[model samples]
Target: MELTLVDLSVARGGVPVLAGVSLSLAPGQALVLRGPNGSGKTTLLRTIAGLQPALSGQVTGAEDRIAYAGHADGLKAMLSVRENLTFWAAVFGMRDVEQAMQAFALLPLADRLAGTLSAGQKRRLGLARLLVTGRPIWVLDEPTVSLDADAVALFAGAVRAHLAAGGMALIATHIDLGLDAAVLDVTPYRVALNGVGFGSSDEAFL
Candidate 1:
């Protein structure tokens, strides 16, 4: 599968953020969006995931294959770790939680309440839900917050496994996710609203 964006324009809060962006991603490939904090990385990812509408232009090739994971973990506080994954799996029409449990190292926390896990542990459980969704295209926004070094490695391994299975991923992150992904700095596509639609700045993402 492949996702192609041609001259895509995206906005947040009814204001243009990213304008005239174009890119293409194929199976087994990953695209990383990098830019300053306010450079619309989240907006662009949401647009690609179909969570929000685009202002203009076209986004093609990605239909129902998108699985979006935003900044929030989206876990039920009272539910156990396994319960959360199983719930999402059922919602996404899957029955297997074994892979997801091992993917994020959630097996150790399987019986633990989501509310009891640390921030990093909760993040892992949240990410594990993606495996059960069975979607081919992953749209993630800052997926590694609060994760320790070991957990980050585990996350990277999961991504690589997904790619090996011919899945594509689009991630918007500050620090590295450890994937050898194509980096697209969105700084150039940002639209400034100083009563005008275009401008330039010197801030680059690290």
Candidate 2:
């Protein structure tokens, strides 16, 4: 399967941020998004992941095929590390969390409450959720935040494994994970304030 974004335009906070963006990702490929702080990388990723709507164009082959990991870790602080993975695993119709735990080295802290773990540990646990997703497309935003070098390497290894298994990834991060991935800079796609652009009143949904 292929994830294709054709002539896509996206907005944030009721204002157009990006326009005329297009890209495609087939199995075993990874695409890294690069842009300045307000360039709409997050907006584009959200649109592709189906978390938000695109003002124009089309996103195909992504329905029920994406596992998104945004800036927020999406963890249940009250749940134990293992329990958290179990919850997410079950949500995606999976039952085993052992492989996910080992992929991120969470076995040692399996019983620890998610809220008690350090920022890096929490991030690791958050990322481990992708392994249990069983989805072929990974849409990640700054996934390495708070992770140490070792943890980043672990995450990179996991991504490599995923790609080797014919999965695709669309990531927005500044750090280099050393993957043979294509980089797409969104700066060129930034919509001019005075230019004709799509508009929306849904300012509350960023």
Candidate 3:
């Protein structure tokens, strides 16, 4: 499946964040969003995932076929890892919950409460929901946050495998994802007051 974001703009408390952003992602393609903090990368991902309202753009995709893993690691803290996975699986209508847990390497921590798991562990469990959902489009915000080296590699490999298998991904990350995906520097896409491009902080051309 393909997704497109056209003429996108976002604001927080009446302050402009992202403006005139447009992007297209197709199957077997991944795009990394790179920018410093407060650069609107996360906001763009959230808007595309339909989590936050888009102020003045269109997100066109198969709404039912999209999966999002945000920065916060959205998991039920009160439930065990297994329970959290099971709950998300049910929400996404997965056929086999055990397989999904095992895929994320959560079998050992399955019995432990999500609240008690380490930061890395929680991120893995949150990402594991995508395995269960089998969505075509993945919108991830800082997917590798708090992950150890091994977990980071695991997440990168999973994303690579997903793209290889004809899935689309929009990743907002500061670190390299180790995938042969294209880069969409949102920094340049930001408009400037005059035609001089003061808001474009992307250094690629410098």
lDDT of each: 0.88, 0.92, 0.79
Residue 189, candidate 2: how far off, in angstroms? 0.4
Predicted candidate 2 versus true structure: per-residue lDDT over 11-122, tens digit per residue: 8766788899999999999999998776788889999999889999999999999999998899999999999999999999999999999999999999999999999999
**Residue ranges of candidate 2 with Cα displaced over 4 Å:** 195-206
Q: Estimate, for each residue in 82-172, the C-alpha lDDT of model 3 and write its tens digit.
A: 8887787788777677766766688999799999998888889988888878798988887887888888888887787888889988888
Q: How does candidate 1 score on lDDT?
A: 0.88
TM-score to true structure, per model: 0.93, 0.94, 0.87
Q: How displaced is residue 77 in candidate 2, in Å? A: 1.2
RMSD score of candidate 3 (Å): 4.8
- Two-way lDDT contest, 1 vs 2, winner: 2
Candidate 3: global Cα-lDDT? 0.79
- lDDT tens digits by residue: candidate 1, 1-206: 58999999998768888899999999999998888777888888888889889999999987988999987899999999999999999999999999999989889899999999999999999899999999999999889988999988998999999999999999988778778899999999988766743233312211
TM-score of 1: 0.93
User: Where does candidate 2 clash, by residue pair?
Assistant: none
